[model samples]
Target: MSAAAPYAALSPDVVLAAVDAAGSWSDGRLLALNSYENRVFQVGLEDGGVVVAKFYRPGRWSDAAIAEEHAFAIELAAAELPMVAPLVIDGQTLLRHEGYRYALYPRRGGRAPSLESRDQLEWLGRLLARIHAVGSRERFVARTTLDRATMIQAPMRAALGSDLLPAHLFDAYRHAAGRVDDAVAQRFEAVGPVRQLRLHGDCHPGNVLWTDAGPHFVDLDDARTGPAVQDLWMLAGDEPMMDALLEGYGQFRDFDPGELALIPALRAMRQVHYAGWIAERWHDPAFPAAFPFAAEARWWEQHIADLHEIADDLF
Candidate 1:
C-alpha cells in the first residue's frame, strides 16, 4: 500500500475489531463499500444481519462536526424521512476504537434514482423540499458554509500554490481562474440576496437511492449551510428539468426564482473546487490513481479553457 493512502491502517482486522467493540458480533464477513473520502464496510453479524460501518477520514472533521452530522441524520429520521441515521450504541452514535472514529448504520439498500423520469424527478423534488424544511429548522454551528471564499478563492489559492499544474501552463491557468472568479462574483451580485439554509450540501444523484417506497438519502458527510438551489440545481440538467423539479418543489416549499441564476455560478465554483480537491489530495495514492487526468498537461490546458468558457457564460 502507498504511504499516501492513510486508510492503509484500516485493515480487515481493524474494521471487524471496531464493529466488535461497538457490541456487534462480526461473522468475519466484510465487504468494502465504494467510497474514497472515507473507508466504509458492510459487516455481517452473527444474527445473519448486516450493518454498514463508516470510518471517517482522520483529521477531516472534529468530534463536534461529526456529532452534528449524526444529529442531522437523526433529526431527519425522526421526521420520518428516508435518510439513514447512525445507530446509537451506549447512548452515542459515534464510536471510537483502536484510534479510529466510526459509526454503524442499519443496512438500507436501493438502486440509483432515475432522474430522466418526470415522475421520479418530481418525487425527488418533493422529497428535497421536505428535507429542506427540516434542515431549515436549525443551523450547523460546526460546519462550513458554501461561499466564494470557501469554494472559489480557497480552491484557486490551493491550485496556484500546488505543483499539480504544469509549469508551462501555470500562467494560463491562473489567468483563467481569476477571470472565472470575477465572473462568479458578478453573477452572485446580479442574483442579489438569497436565503441560506442548512442544505444537503452535496445533493448529486449518487447520494440518493430509490426503491418502491421512494428515495432515501445517504451520507451527510458533506452536509453544510447553503442556498436551497444548491441541492436542486445538481439534479436538473436543463430548463425543462428544472421546471419539473420546481413544479414538484412548489408543492412543498416555495422556491425563489432568483436562485436559478446562481446555477451557473455554482457550477463554476464546483469546477474550481473539484480541481483543488483533487490537487490537495494528490499526495494520496487513491487520488492519483483515480484522477489520472489531473496529472496531464493537456488536461490542465483544457481545464483552463473550460474555466474561460464558464466565465464567458456567466458574464
Candidate 2:
C-alpha cells in the first residue's frame, strides 16, 4: 500500500515503529482508515488499547500550519465541544519518525450521520454554533483562510499545470473556471465584509461521526478561517434541512442570512478546487485509483461545460 515518494517510505513496519516510538506499543494490528490527503491508521496497542495515527502528507502542510491545527482542535475539545483532539505524546502532538511527521488520536468510532433526520440536523447545528463561538475567540496565524485566492485561484493554477487537462480543452477549462472565479468574486463583493472565524473547513457529512451518545467531529486537517456558512451549508442537503439546522443553530448564535448568498459561490469554488486537487495530486496512486475519471478527456469536457453552466446559473 505504498504510494509515491514520501508516502512510499511509510510502510507497515514504519507505521508500527512510529507508534512504538510514540510510547504506544503496537500489537502489530493496524487498520487503514478512510483518508486521502494523508495516511491514517487504527493501530492496536499492547495495553489492549487502540488509537488512530495520521501521517501528514509530506510538503502539504508546514509545521507551523499543522501546529495551529492541533492547537485549534485542543482548544475546541477543551471548550467541551465534541471534538477529536490529537493526543499529546511526550509533550508533543506532532512527532517525527523516519523523516515523516505524524500524530496520534484516541480512536473514536461512529456511523455516518443521517442528514435526513431532523433531530440529527438540529443536533449538528447546535454543536456547530458552539464550535463557531469558540472559533471566533481567536484566529489561526498559520492555517489557511477560505478565500478566493486559496480555494479558487491556487487550484486553478495547479490544475492547469497538470498534464491531465486536454490541450484542446485547456482554454475551455480555463475560461469556464475563470467565469466561476469572477462570479464568486462578485458574490463576495455583494455580501460585503464577513466575520471570518475558525471553522471545520470541510464539514460535509463524511467528516462527522455519529453515535447514540451524540456526534463528534473528526479530521480537523482541513480546518481554516472562513464564513460560518462554509461549515453550515455542507451539512444541509436542502432548504428544509437548512431550516431545521438554523432552528437549532439559533439556540446558540445568530445566523447571518446574507452569508446564504455565498453558498452557490462556495459550491462553484469547491467544484473547481476538487478537480484542481486531484490534478495536483494525481501523482499519488491512491488519487488516480479513487478518481479514475479525472484522467478521461470526456470528464474534463463535461467538467468544463458544468463550470460554464454553473457560471450561467450564477448570473
In order, what is each prediction's RMSD in angstroms? Answer: 1.6, 1.4
- Candidate with best lDDT: 2
What digit string (tens of lDDT, one per residue) describes model 2 on residues 1-315?
334555888889999999999999999999998788999999999999999999999988999999999999999999999999999987899999998999999998899999999999999999999999999999888998998899999999998999989888888889999999998998899889988999999999988999989999999999999999999999988999999899899999998988999899999999999999999899887888899999999999999999999999887
lDDT of 1 by residue, 1-315 (tens): 343676777899999999999899999999998887888999999999999999988887899999999999999999998899999999999999777889999999999988889999998889889999999999999988888888988888888888998888889988999999999999999989898888888888899999888899999999989899999999999888888898899999999998988999999999999998888778877788889999999999899999999999999
Worst 10 residues of 1 by lDDT: 1-10
* Each candidate structure's count of clashing pairs: 0, 0
The models' CA-based lDDT, in order, is 0.91, 0.92
Query: Which candidate has the highest TM-score of all?
Result: 2
Write out the backbone clash pairs for model 1. none
> Which ten residues in a row are the worst by lDDT in model 2?
1-10
User: How far does residue 253 in candidate 2 sit from its true spot (Å)?
Assistant: 0.8
